[model samples]
Target: MTAQAYCPDPWTPTAGENARTSALVDRFVELEAQVARARAEQATLLVSLAEIAVEQGRRSGSESEYDFATRSIAAELGAAARIPEGTIRGRMADAVTLVTGFPATFAALQEGRISEPHTRVIVAAGERLDDDSRVEFEGIVVSRAEGVTVGQLRSFARAVAEKIDPVPLTVRQAEAMALRGAWVSPLEHGMAEHRMIGPAATIYAIHDRLTQAATKLKATARAAGEPDPRTLDHIRADVLADLTLTGTPTAGDGLDAIHATIQVTIPVDTITGIGDDAAFLTGYGPIDPDTARRLAGNAATWVRVWQHRDTGALLTVDSYTPTAAQRRFLTARDEHCRFPGCRQPARRCDTDHTIPHSHDGPTTVTNLAHLCQAHHRLKHHSPWRMRQGPDGEIEWTSPTGRTYAHKPTPMVRFDAEAEVLMPDLHLSDEPPPF
Candidate 1:
């Protein structure tokens, strides 16, 4: 029976294996199509809900009521789905635009030929165009979306939209200039992010200047045989800080005197060198104990905060004054806006009375919470209601009767430590150089 020995090519797939692979590929494609269809259906439903809300509000006989109705519906849906109301509101707006403004693109998504991202890009690109021009823009971009990646489609759609726009470029540029501004956000590992939005040319020029400065500094270090551990990115960031902090601005008014302010909450044991608990950077999250010590060392005054041993809620500060200490306590307890998913820094927020003072609410810590201006107005105008719970938790009840609880951020913990390598810069009893 050893007459014939069978051999199979290792590189080749058997018929059975080939059939299984084909089936797998087919299943993957089918799943992708299913997802696209699901997204399309969701968009349609959101649009329908918005329309219903608007119609219901129309009976109330005011535009303000109509707006409130839309927001109320969004908040209800957001609470039920565990999503941020602001995010859901934005999505509802996008859904309306997608279905009404760009029907062809929506149809493409419905047919499983394009994705949600593709529809978004197309809608955003053609948003400023007239109805006729938008239709023309969609006719071209929808076909391109099916073939190209989302990024490519975005670029193409932008170029096409610009060409088709009825408004002059100069007019758009002037309007866009009003929106130019800078903002900061906290990042992971005890770092903060700065973003500036301006004219494309001006932003690029500023970046180019930073790059040139960084390049020169690196070359000088290399020439001097200095072991410069910093990368170009690091040097560029440092140069940006240095120029902004030390270099005089062209208008040079009181800007130089305006120093950045941040509140840091350090544990007593951490400061006494008996513990390594992470310090909370107030608006930001946790920073290492060593950096906290350095910041504390440079401070002219320190307010010691007392916390409950069982719960980490802020009890009071060391101040004897009632109002000032209460303000400090509230700021420390509510690190940011108490509204669910709102992170507007507490320093910039208004201390809102959970129960109106007119209704006999006392001016105490439990009756007060920090809310950004927008959310504060939303609380008063919309059907949303909130009540403070134990340990600084805020329970928000949406119009549809769903509740969401947002707990106060902890001030002291050993976890969430971000290891940041300190740059070699001169530190003194003054505002931070960068």
Candidate 2:
């Protein structure tokens, strides 16, 4: 037998011809333990350094030393290869000091609890404050962090802002506040359409543009009693145009055909007590656990199920029964989607049939699979399709219908250069350290 010829065993580890498989297992365990300790230490050091750097900036008046300290820490972190410079500075500022960086620094504020937005206000305000006042301001925030819940923290921030520097005090502020204490100056706004060429933008990006255009057209729409500046049909068409303008793989017959879809309307019952649609997990996107459980809870109650061996059992008004062996096969062969490059846990992935259940596929281990929601939808609706090849690789076909073979996820591969630095499990009590 050769490596890559068969998947490595979870319990039975076979090594070089004469070595005991158990020895390989022992080495693996030892290595795992070592990695755990290294990660824990790294997290502690990083957070501790952040705390120290913030203090030094406050107490050490020498601009040269502060600059040197910052440069040194940044350099050290960069060399580590895993730490992002923007992320590092932001963490330190939010968690320890309040001098530099914008959004990243805000993250430091929650320590681990609040959120990026909450910290942004503090950093934005700090920009206008003098060094002494800024540090004083940070001190107040740090004190509040010890006992503040999320709601209290937001309120406390308002109090802190008032204490440090209540709204710009000079002529610039008087002119900026045309509407009194109601809003930030309109001058602060800027339009950002990062990909104007593309037809598809995020709902967040779309919302911003809509806000800008809405304000510009607000008076006319309101006078006419129109609900929106633009009609829904216009928006949808424009959005499609947006995606097309942005470089989607429109040239390919493979799934760049965004216009296609398969609508599967399985009749749903009011799941015991839940009001929300119970989501079927396809892969690792964010769906609630209650949704995952709903399908399972009502599995037996499904009077008629459309059993697709590879995709798992789906209950419609139609029905069928599985042999006892098939049930055991489902439990053993498929815990989740077998798609490479995905880790949503087995339970969260859809149980797919290796062969089409509609084509009289057998309910056997070799005929089962699990795909997460994203991939599942792609399989059924998009131009993308899946097929088990002769070599055992699950080939994914694109919109153009070209098949791309996805290798299994390298879950076990941890190169020395690729490991994530450990997060501080314990240490600073500030912000909460998300």
Candidate 3:
């Protein structure tokens, strides 16, 4: 037998050891400086690597400098770095901004007087100012960096940038409005965050409406001698979600028409209480079985999809009108865009024929896939090649002949009872006009 590996116990201060605790605290202070220096070194390396990528791009005459830098760094660093390529590119750009525009701020960061977050705040605001104005803005921000918190630093920098901006306030407002949109981010505890960027006045009005409804509901609960269980913030969030989903304050018996269609696929066994399998929310991944059943009960329409049990391959997609029902089937199968790394939901994407319809490709389930607008254009304009497998898997070939396969992540977890429930589910013979 091989020798057993030795694992050391984690270091911890003994109780009542004031000297050890003080020494540990002092060491930590020294480590903070070490960490800052390490971070500065890493930034320098990243800058050098990005410069090398630019030189390589010039020599190869193939990929752009940015594409080369992002792909190269992401590939070399791997996912353990926990930084996305876009973030890496953005940080490299910020590093340049700091070194060129705010030397004092960068020096403070290197010396551990200020942090990377502080540097980022300065760089972000300074980028908006003219060269002459940026120097003045940097002077104001860097002086306060060591003393102020990151949040305060951001606020101060923003204030300085606004005061020093060369563009007229109206023009800047127009530019800011052009950037408005909704963004989704993953959060802890199996939840996700939704952020909307828009006019402050419009947002405030919506918030006021939600607050009014929440307050009224709270008062109603109190008058009825019932506990006001949810907090004001929670009630407001629910109200916002309810309005956004159903386009009304109250969601009625069935799901209402909205901007995007939500599709949920649940095993018949779970729906009928035979099994506890979770349902797949088209773009959002798996939700609890109870939520699935509740949503299904309120669905305006449903399309039944059939697939092979063993391989999870599409068996026979229902033959329907080449419009609504067809879209439902594809959305159920693909869940999101067929692009290699994209997660844009099918509802917001365009269904494109894998083979060009101009070349006589039929508009059928086997020949169709959902692609976000950006990827759809890329498919047509770029040299990226695509092919569909017999089982609806997508194979993408990049311009450099690198091939990647994309298969939809299935929502169902297999159990022996799945076979028993299969015959009773998703077998609707009716295909009414939608």
Candidate 4:
């Protein structure tokens, strides 16, 4: 056998691994086709699931009962499919749109003529309208979706959405104002992404200022005969960071009052050296407990919120009153707009009465929820229905009769003894926990 030392057939370059650009392009084309087919199959499955959900709702008498059943089933579906719960909800929404509202788009998807992303663009473009308008809109756009690239299709879709929007211009302007805010999301390598959405004029003004400052910094470096080490983009980023952190254009040069309020919610045990669980950063998600400690220690004001131990649900804070306290509690509780998939932060949103005050709905926490101005108006004007569950969960029923549930993110609960002793323990005394 050793003497025979047999060799297998000489290996060939797999699809795109070789140096040929044409081979790589061909391989990509094939892959895209495969992906389209897979997406089509997934859509088919989702359509079936949507039909089942509708049927189940019809069978169930109460909306609450239907919601409970559907959510439980959704959890099961998410688990079996190995998808996140949020993703499953999004898929369900898309399925409803494809199967019911945009049958032509659905057919295109089934034939693998368009991918899921194209379908999403189509669906989102027509989302503000009822099924009839969507059908008409899809008829106009579906063919273009098949022909044009995704980016081009998106531009077309935006035009369509703008043309078909039923909201009056004055009302739309108000909604736009309410939607203006900033948010942060964690990124790879301990970096983060910060996004601010505002009026075009306001954003443009800010951008112009940043650009001017960046140019000046670069020019200053050149005049000093020092290397302009930073790119325009890098300089702009640094300038923005310096402006935000130090309340001045440059760090450590001239100090201005820090007027921004940053809220950090952390577990007591984490700061007490008992545990290392992540802490909550308002307008952001989890951060290192050490970072939380630093923020709290440096902050001029800190509010302690006691949460439930087992479920990590927030209980109450002692500092608030019946009126002001309720508002603060609602802000902490909701954290964001109660509408499904809407991430507009609670502080920026209007506290809406689930049942209108005119209808004798009390101004109690049970009757109130945070809704961005757009969604707030949408809820009031459209066929969309909202109700608060006994447990303070918000359930939204779409015009198509689909029900969605939104729950607040749970807070980490600390012990009563820890809460009592927290005021005595100074956050700055310990070394950096990192």
**Highest TM-score model number:** 1
Q: lDDT, candidate 1, residue 196?
A: 95
Ranking by lDDT: 1, 3, 4, 2
Q: Tell me each candidate's TM-score.
A: 0.47, 0.29, 0.44, 0.46
- Relative to the unseen true structure, what is the C-alpha lDDT of residue 309 in candidate 1, on a scale of 0 to 100? 61
Candidate 3's TM-score reads 0.44
Q: Which portions of model 4 miss their true places by more than 4 Å? A: 1-19, 183-194, 204-233, 243-434
Cα deviation of 118, candidate 4, in Å: 2.6
Q: Model 1: per-residue lDDT, tens digit, 1-434?
A: 11111121224445676577667767886888788889999999999989988997899999999999999999999999999999998999899988888899889889999888888888877898989998898887788777656754554576567657777554665677799999999999999999999755345446656665665666666777984789979977886787798793232323334333456677777676777655555433344566677767766666665544654444432222225545666666665688876766576567776765545545556667888777776676656677886556778765445566776653333222221111111111111211
Mind giving the per-residue lDDT tens digits that candidate 3 earns over 122-195? 88777877788877887887877776557545544665565567664446656777989999999999999999
Q: Candidate 2 vs candidate 4: which has greater lDDT? A: 4
Ranking 2 against 3 by TM-score, winner: 3
Q: What TM-score does prediction 4 earn?
A: 0.46
Question: Each model's C-alpha lDDT?
Answer: 0.66, 0.41, 0.61, 0.61
lDDT of 2 at 231: 65
Compare candidates 1 and 2 on lDDT and give the better one: 1
**Superior candidate under lDDT, 2 versus 3:** 3
**TM-score of model 1 (CA atoms):** 0.47
Q: Which of candidates 1 and 4 is the stronger one according to lDDT?
A: 1
Question: Which candidate comes out best when scored by lDDT?
Answer: 1
Better of 2 and 4 by TM-score: 4
lDDT of 4 by residue, 1-434 (tens): 00111112233444344346555666886787678778877767777776676678778877786676567667788999898877886787777767777788878877778877898888876777776667678877888777555654664565555445565333555666799899999999999999999754345335545665766677667777985888989977887888788768763222233223334456677666576555554443344555556656765555554435654434333321225545655666666677866766565567766655545555666666778777776665555667886456777765444566665544423334122111111111011221
